[model samples]
Target: MRQWETAYEKWKNDEGLDAHLKQELDAMHDQPEALEDAFYRDLAFGTGGMRGVLGPGTNRMNIYTIRKAVNGLAHYLKNHCVNVNDRGVAVSYDSRHMSKEFAVETAKVLGAHGVKAYVFNTLHPTPLLSFAVRYLGAAAGVMITASHNPPEYNGFKVYNEDGGQVTPDEAAAITEAIQKTEDELSVPYLEQEEIEAKELLTWGGQEVDNAYLEQLESITKLDADEQEQTKDLQIVFTPLHGTACDLVQRGLDNLHFHQVDVVEEQAVPDPEFSTVDSPNPEEHQAFTMAMELGKQTNADILIGTDPDADRLGAAVKNDTGDYAVLTGNQLGALMLDYILRHTDPKLLPNARMIKTIVTSELGRRIADSYGVQTMDTLTGFKYIGEKIRQFDATGEAFIFGYEESYGYLISDVVRDKDAVQSAIFACEMAYYWKKQGKTLYDALQSLYETYGYYVEDMISLKLTGKQGSEKIARIMQAARTESFTDIGGVDVLAVEDYWTSERMVAGSSQPEEIDLPQENVVKFLLKDDCWICLRPSGTEPKLKCYVSVRGDSEEDSRKRLTKLKTAMDHFLHRTQS
Candidate 1:
């Protein structure tokens, strides 16, 4: 029998497997493709952690896989964490199917090994989880969420003591330990009663919220009177049936934004996310209910948070009296402009902003206008969080950080992308503009007028399952082997191959070394000030291509982007889907 067949047989016959899971396995026994997809390989625990569809297989996220992943963390903690028992792991979950169960399972796995676990009593956002790690002084942390993925997906994320995702080295060490683990069915876990009796598991969240909210005082730029000035700034917020409802609402109330309205249908935690096709706020469809509420209330702005409440999306009324969804890049630039314009000059001396390499350069230009510096890291918020830690020691303050995927962090209080904080700051920005008789749309257009037209678009191609992974690998390898001279009639000024840590210029025989972690990403800088980047998604089964272009007019930029995307599609073996 093949390895997959043997693995399938073992799972099917194991009486230790849960009956429901066994039934699921048995149901797929006759479907060879389904069985192979589920058993071909272990679910990848990447630089962050494991994310996959929820089911009962080695490649799926189930009790066994959750325990196995946590077991790996336990092993790493046992070897590396000082005072592991006294400073244990903190765990929090979001509103996803089995999110709470996976969180408890992680705690139980740690508890069985005599490592204490502080688990959340209820669902919470990713930012709160990051804060709890430092607040509790835990050795590490785990958040049970898939961020903005669909409801069918859930994940486990590991964080270091500094509340940042584990570094590449840490993830590699944990992955090694995970491979050493065997007999998934035999992994032991303590029950909740036993966990409580032994003081192995405790509940958190409310206290963390208090501490986080207290810290929010220093980050929000506008004061109460300033907020009250734009009382006409009607705001509509929807958590998309996730975790941000209570906390975000409370924070806005504290600021006395009396005109705020929450989408009644999406305020409650619904694991199914029944109100929207997908809970991801990045998609326009996710804003349907929120937009309706916005129209009814004559709201000036609408905000939507994803399932884990880490990514936020918004729509602002345009000159035509219709609302237009602001792209992630647009939002980032707007926030950067607002922050730099209003921040104290004393604070501006060391204020720095961070963004991913794929993010728009408009933010960098805006920062340059203010004489502040900007830094770019690889595609994860964890790397941005790492910079926060470095900033803390070097006397540089984190003014803001954002990714092109609708994730933003306005402060270092939380070491990850924070929709709650973003929502609050975005509200203030809207109100600040409202008092000026302008909308965010007006503010964005004024920015384009000041800075040249800088527009960007991201295209993601979903190629799922085993074959999908192999295909993605092939595409990256092919790009590595071939050298490109230009794209869209623009000369390639330089090329950055992150996988090899090389920066290749046309005349330089020897490539310069990049001061960033080696990863499977390719970037090209064009002579026309346009750039395109290619990389595989770290958390999802998709190949992402990002393009940015600056032109004299919006129409000119759109034309250039169209030609550029065609060139990318041809070069990357993908079409605009």
Candidate 2:
């Protein structure tokens, strides 16, 4: 018998797989490429968790695969805990295909392993899962979401006890445990009724939602009166058919932004995300419907959230009354400036902020101007969450946290990025600007004037499927190996290799430690304040390169960015060739 056929036969003989999966296997019995893609290797567990295309395979995010991951987690918890079964885990999911099912699978696996599980009764946002973990004092949390991925995709994100995504060390431990598990079907799982009867499964719904919303309210700087005056401020919002519609709308209402309008067609939950090609809010095309609604309503601002609603995107009326989509950096800088200006002095001294190193340095300058200390972490909200936890432990107040990819966290109550919080804050900012007879575009331009024209752009080189994965790894390796002396007529002053945790200065043999968790990333700082960073996307088969340049004028900044982009593109193409 052929190798794949024999393997397929063995898999068919297994009793652990349901008829559905067995049928799928049978359908793909003759498809060598599909089988190879399905079982070439197991889906890897990275720092956050395992994420992949959902299908019936060892390599996909199926029930069996999820069960394996949960069993590994359960085993890890058991080994580390004094009372393995009693220590619980919280679970939540977004409005992706099979997200709720995946959450239930996770809970069931935890329950069967004698670990208690608290699961949301319906679709929930990713940030709430983080909040629920800490609120329930669980040992860990699991969120079933693919964030802004296409409808064909889904994922799993694991959080530590502190309510942050799992760190490298923790993820490594779990990955090791997952590797030790031989057969995914062998992992135990409790039936839903049995788990409920045993009192090991608890349903979290309105009670947790109420508490989360209450905590979200506490993060607001605008009072009811301020919101009352600005309540009529016209705003358009779209959740892109994910999980944020109700929470974001409710939060805005509670804040008294009564004129907030939802893009009705896109507001409803849709696993297929039929309205848009992709649900990512960062893309201007994703906001087409929202922008149309904004224009119709004469809305001052247009806001969008990804499927899970942890990240936010905005568009504002420009000088000509046409809508202009603001980058994450622009939105963040505006928020930082607005919050600092209106907040009390007592809040200033204790207030601090964080952003990923790849995020715009403009935010740092804005924070510094207001005497707010800002720190940089490696890419990912997990590091930002880690910083928040450290600050909370040391009595330092967290003013804000964000990444360049539109994720922001305004409140400490939720350890992950909170789009619900961001939506409210953005509405308040818009209202404040409207009361002043100014637009958010005007505010952004003011920020640019003060910060000296900063522009940031990201390029993602997509590699799909198994072959794409190998290419991505090769690209990262190639970037690390190559040396660039100059870019866009600017001399490279330093190269920060995150994987080695070392920064090599120009003309210096010695390297300094970066003092952050080590990861596979490289960043080059140029002499003219232009920078480029290269890193692989954790959730997708892509290598992301970020470029930031600051100039004395907007035109100058654009020119510099274009030059840098062209040079980088040529450089990348040449290297790849």
What local lDDT does model 1 show for residue 506?
Answer: 69
Candidate 2, residues 141-252: lDDT per residue as tens digits? 8999989987878899999888899888888999998889888877888898999999889997788788888887777777766645537688899999999988888888
Question: Which candidate number would show the highest TM-score if scored against the true structure?
Answer: 1
Worst window of 10 by summed lDDT in candidate 1 = 224-233
With a 3 Å backbone cut-off (N, CA, C), the pairs that clash in candidate 2 are none
- Report the lDDT tens digits of candidate 1 across residue range 1-577: 9887777788888978888789888888679999988887888999979899988788998999999888888989989889998799999999899999898899889989899999999999988989899999999999999987877889999999999888898899999998888767778889878988899999867788988887876676777566444355689999999999988878887777778899988998987889888888888999998888888999999999997889999999998998899999999999999989888877786888999999999998899989889999999998999999998789888889999999899878789999998998898889889889899999999999998999898778899997787888888877776777878888888889999999998667999999999999999888767999989999999999899999989999999999999887786674222
TM-score of 2: 0.96
- Best candidate (score: lDDT): 1
